[model samples]
Target: MTQRYSVLLWLTGGLVVLFLIAPILAIMPLSFNSEPFFTYPMPGLSLRWYEEFFTSNVWLMSLKNSLIVAVCATILATFLGTLAAIGLARKECPVRGLIMAILISPMIVPIVVSAVGIYYAFAAVGLLNSLTGLILAHTALGAPFVLITVSASLAGFDYNLMRAAANLGARPHTATLQIMLPMIAPGVFSGALFAFATSFDEVVVALFLTGSEERTLPKQMWSGVREQLSPTIAAVATMLILLSTLLLIVMLWLQNRAEKQKQRLEG
Candidate 1:
């Protein structure tokens, strides 16, 4: 009976995975379609759409904007979130739970609601429709993931090591850089990947916050889908899928490394 149940669970899990991935798998082939439309049963396969994406100024600019925004947001989120995590992990930190809840509120709140609020707030300050505004919004959204990951990493941390470093005449900053930073590096990197992916793939907030000049890749894709169903969008989607897969692999590797580090520390 146990064996039968295990097989049934595997089948159910496989179906769920297939359901999630099928659309992504279906679009990849259409990217190479010679025709402009996204329909299947292609007349012939060509890399024309991919070539268009690479060569087109608008698409290239959008790609550049996405890279810039994502990189900036990742760095900001990782730094702020790691600091917040360290503070929250401390036993004597004041109002720790409340502060943590506020920090991560973006993750809990509906994104549309968050976007609307941000739009008005930025508008009041003349920050709307700018790269700075978009980066700030993305940093808010991405920071929670960093906080959660780094906090988990800190859960296994030994505060005694910090004390030992102090006893050995090390400054606090030196201890953090040489000791705590190395231990939590994997989680920090994993969180950075999540933060980058979040900023890169974000659409709704980008639509609300950005002007034409500040458009990101996802924003450009949204415009293409609405204006005309271009096979170029499919090509872009395929490239994004490849990028996401690579990030996912790296995140998994970092997670495994973190686990091994934890085991070593415990042992």
Candidate 2:
């Protein structure tokens, strides 16, 4: 009976995973469809869409812009989020709940509303239609994820470790850098990856903040879908799917590593 139940659970989980991933996986073969349309049973396998995706100047530039914004936003978001998380984790921090609510409100708020507000704010500062504006906007959108992950990691941290480091003549910042940061490295990295993914795939903010010169890959994809629905989009989507899968794998590994580290620390 137990064996049957175990088999049923495994099969159920497998089906759920397949259901979630099927749509994404379905696009991969369509990307290689020889005909421009996304029809089943392939007109014949071809690499034309992939070639176009690689060789097109517009596609390349959009990809470049996305990478630049995502990287910059990831760095800024991670730094700010880590500091914010650390502050919030402190028992004595003033109005921690209120402050955290504000910090992570971006995650709860509708992105379109945020983008509209950001657009007006950027316009006032003359930052609209630029990479800088896009980076800043993406940073706001990404920072909450970083904060959440780091805070969860910090939950298991031992304050005594910090005190011991301080007693050894280390400064507060030094202790944080050398001791606390190392222990939470996996969370920090995982959060940064999430931040990068958020920024990389973000489109609404980019649509509002960026111009032709600063168009990111997602914005480009959006435009393509709206204007032409090109098979090149399928190609790009497949590549992005692969990238997303890689990031997911890395996050899972980091989470597992953090669990093992926490066990060791607890033991």
Candidate 3:
């Protein structure tokens, strides 16, 4: 009976995986279709759409904007969030619980609601329809993920090591940079990936905050969906999928490296 149950569970899991992945797999071939439409059984496979995606000025500009915003947001979020997490991990930190809730509230609140609120707030401050505004908003949305990851990394951290560093005449900042940051690097990097992904793919906030000039890749894709409905969007999607897969591979590698480092440290 147990063996039968185990086999059934395995089959169910495999089916679930297939169900989730099949749609994404289906889209790849459509990107290569020689025709403009998204129909199945392509008449021929061609790189026409890929060529269009690369050659189009609009798509290229949007891609550049996305990279700029994502990279800036990720860097800011990682730095600020790492500091916040380190502070919270300290035993003497005041109002840790309340601070944590406030820090992570952006992730909790509904995205549309946050966008609306940001829209109004930015308008008041004249931050609307600008790359700087968009980057700041993305940083707000992404910092919580960084905080969570770094906090988890700091959970088993050793305060005694900091004291030892101090006793050895190292300054607090020096100890943190030299000793603590190195140990928590995996978490910082993982959080950075999450921040970059969030900033890169965020559409709702982009729609609310940006003008056409500042549009990111997702915004451009949304525009293409509404206005053009071209096969170039499919090619862009395929490229994004490839990029996501690369990021996932890097994350897995980081996780494995972190585990080995942890073991070595513990040993």
Candidate 4:
């Protein structure tokens, strides 16, 4: 009975994985579809849509903008979130719980609520529709993800090593760079991946805050998706899937490395 149950569980898990991957995989062949419409089992297979995606200035520009925004947001959120996580994890900090709550509140709050507030705030500051404004908003949303990942890593972190580093004449920054950052780097990198994914996939806030000039990939896709359903967007989706897969691989590697580090520390 137990063996039978185990087999059943495996089958169920496989089904779930297939379900999740189906839509993404569907986009792949659809991109090569000779039909302009978004459908499969094409009369012929061609790279026409792929060519369109690459050649179209609007699509190419949006892709560039998305990459820039994701990179910038990832860096900013990872730096700030890693620092904040370290501070929060230290025992000497006062009101650490409160600080952590405040840091993560953005994640808990409804995105629409936050979007409205940011829209108004950016509008007032004359930052609406600007790259900087979009970056700032995405960074704010992405930081909580960084904080969550880094804090998880720090949960198993050693503090005595930090003390030893300090005693060995290492300055605070030096100790952080050599000891702390290395120890927690997997978590930091995982956090950065999440931040990049969040910023890259985000659309609602971008919709509200962005203008024609500063449109990200999702925004461009959104506008085009409504006017006419085309296979070009499917091509973009496949690219996004590939990018997401790469990031996921990076995150998994980091997580496995972190686990090994934890085992070493514990041993």
Ranked candidates (lDDT, high to low): 2, 1, 3, 4
- Alpha-carbon RMSD to native, per candidate: 0.9, 1.4, 1.1, 1.4
Q: Count the backbone clashes (under 3 Å) in each candidate.
A: 0, 0, 0, 0
lDDT tens digits by residue: candidate 1, 105-143: 999999999999999999999998899999999999999
Tens-place lDDT per residue, model 4, 1-267, is 999999999999999999998877777888888888765567888888889989999998998899889899889999899889988888899999999999998899998999999999999999898889999999999999999999999899888998999989999999989998888889998999999999999999999998898889999999988887888888888888899999999899999999998998799
1-267, model 2: which lDDT tens digit per residue?
Answer: 999999999999999999999998888999999899888888699999999998999999999999999999999999999999999999999999999999999999999999999999999999998999999999999999999999999999999999998889999999999999999999999999999999999999999998889989999999999999999999999999999999999999999999999999788
lDDT of each: 0.95, 0.95, 0.93, 0.90
Q: What is the model-wide C-alpha lDDT for candidate 2? A: 0.95
Predicted structure with the largest TM-score when compared to the true one: 1
The ten-residue window of minimal lDDT in model 4 covers 33-42
TM-score of each: 0.98, 0.96, 0.97, 0.95
TM-score, prediction 2 = 0.96
Model 2: how far is 54 from its true place, Å?
A: 1.1
| Alpha-carbon deviation at 258 in model 3, angstroms | 1.4
Q: Write the per-residue lDDT of candidate 3 for residues 1-267, one digit (tens) a residue.
A: 999999999999999999999989999899999998889788999999999988889999999999999999999999999999999998789989999999999999999999999999999999999999999999999999999989988986778899999999999999999999999899889989988888998999999999989989999999999998998988899999999998889988887888888788789
- For candidate 3, what is the TM-score? 0.97
